[model samples]
Target: MQNQSFLAMEDPLDALCHHFSLTKALLPPNARIPPTFDMTLSAPPSRQPTHLFAILPPEDNARVPTLMIPVSAGLYGQSFAADLLPAGTALPVPHIQNGNGAQPPCVTLPVVPVSAPHSLSIPLVLLFGLGLETDRNLLAQRMLPAQVIGEFPHFPAMVGVMAKLPEQQFEWYLGYTHGMWKNVLALAPKDAGLVEFVQMAHKVIVEAGRLRGRR
Candidate 1:
């Protein structure tokens, strides 16, 4: 009997790819892989140190830490600023320091800023909520990409596209993983290694689609 169950589902990207046997054909050539880049999003490359800075706690004795997420230099910067940042500002979060010798009850760190080619526009910053004094070790490892994806809509959707490929299509699989890494890095300040990844992955996606079209 034909497998009619999967056809009934709303999202057929994964299932449909599996139903067909074209997964292996879509894999990129091993020699075509870039030497400086790694497909897994496990860690930032040697030169491209990951940018994860602690954002000040919102409330007194709060138990969370918010971090900065930057964007790339492009025309879309304004769109990002207008869509995300709070009103009347270039930088979304303001500096927080107590007048007295003691620490302020709440701290607000500046949102990650980008020097794009775009014109002056409203401020754009996104503040993530993290409780105070959390363990750095625990947070880094325990936090799933899904959790981070939940917080930000932009990269998640792009990553969603890559997730549709079958397991045998290692090329596309790597592309998907690396694409997500590039997407995350694009949001942060310019890192040379990451910049390389973004350019390469963008080309990979475009080329992959072309290959699929010709087949």
Candidate 2:
């Protein structure tokens, strides 16, 4: 059934491939598999050193510990890190002083302004939440990537996808586990392929919910 779905939606599958390539090119050189952290479609964990690359809502700035690196709008009418930062540019790392006056542990993270030619040497948690709305722009302005919407329409969607694939494959191929698939579901236009994908994902989410209840 999964094979048939993949075969039937050849165009969307191809679009997925293209999206993956385009998104990967924007990742920092030192970007590695981020540590396991709890996340959801509406809310991300507040305390963890998680890296997010989504168009976040304004409130997220306070909820999540993130350093904003504003960039020029991309040709696709979206803002991306690669467009703003030059290749091989050194990103600024801020040091936080513990209130106890104790020397904080030296933490290494990937630098910002992730350019194409340069590679970040330090391991940083890179959260790829593209299309998340940080500004008060209209709904159309915050449309997320099709891949994100298709695979992770909601938190349950992550659970659904995870149930089907091994951890390694999911992490290596998709980068992040949690997503706002519901957001995408709301914004997506009426297209046969997209609707079919959403339906399949929705079923997976429902089944996952059922299994969770059983547990």
Candidate 3:
């Protein structure tokens, strides 16, 4: 059975292509094989979205650590900000409500010179929970300034720094992963490595941040 090369395959991309009978012709330079996942959303075909952008973890079969974002009209960037909305909040538990999600919290700090009685225009509450779950000092000093910077002067996803979030809260927080990617996609060139499995997985995080693969 050692000669049965199929089982010997370690690369998830190769396995995905082999199992799915995919053609690699005309593929980009990396020849990445999209991962296969089983999604059974009750949303009908017509209502189901057709565009998606994903960033996979480095390890093989890295679905568990993958990030998937929705793509609207083949555009996923700052220019497409209107398409990416904060469906809800994700702090203590997943409070996501699609169209009824919470806006960025309206901060009323003690005599702070920031905005007042006003939720942050950016959809950060849905993506990163108002940037106030933990790391009070760091977020106060860093995240808040970018978040309230006028609804998205650019995509404001700070994944590298948010690594300190709790596992479950962080996972649930993925509901807004799209907001993060769209911003990055807007600024990135089409061929600038943000396209495959994707070229910019390092540059963007997924909607759910659950890290699923595609095929």
Model 1, residue 157: distance off in Å is: 24
- What digit string (tens of lDDT, one per residue) describes model 1 on residues 1-215? 32332223312222222232111111122222111111122212111211212222234423432222222212223322232333443433222333344532222333322222211100111111111112222222212233333433354443444344444563543444343444344344233443343344454445444544565
- For 68-148, candidate 2 gives per-residue lDDT tens digits of 222112211232222433343333232222223353222222333322110110001111223221121111112223333
Residue-level lDDT of model 3, residues 67-138, one tens digit each, is: 332222222233333333223211122121222244321111111011111122122221122111222232
Stretches of model 3 off by over 4 angstroms after superposition: 1-36, 45-47, 58-64, 75-142, 145-215
What Cα-based lDDT does every candidate model obtain? Answer: 0.29, 0.29, 0.27
**Best candidate, TM-score:** 2
Worst 10 residues of 1 by lDDT: 119-128
Off by over 4 Å in 1: 1-105, 109-190
- For each candidate, how many residue pairs have backbone atoms clashing (under 3 Å)? 10, 11, 16
- For model 1, the local distance difference test gives 0.29
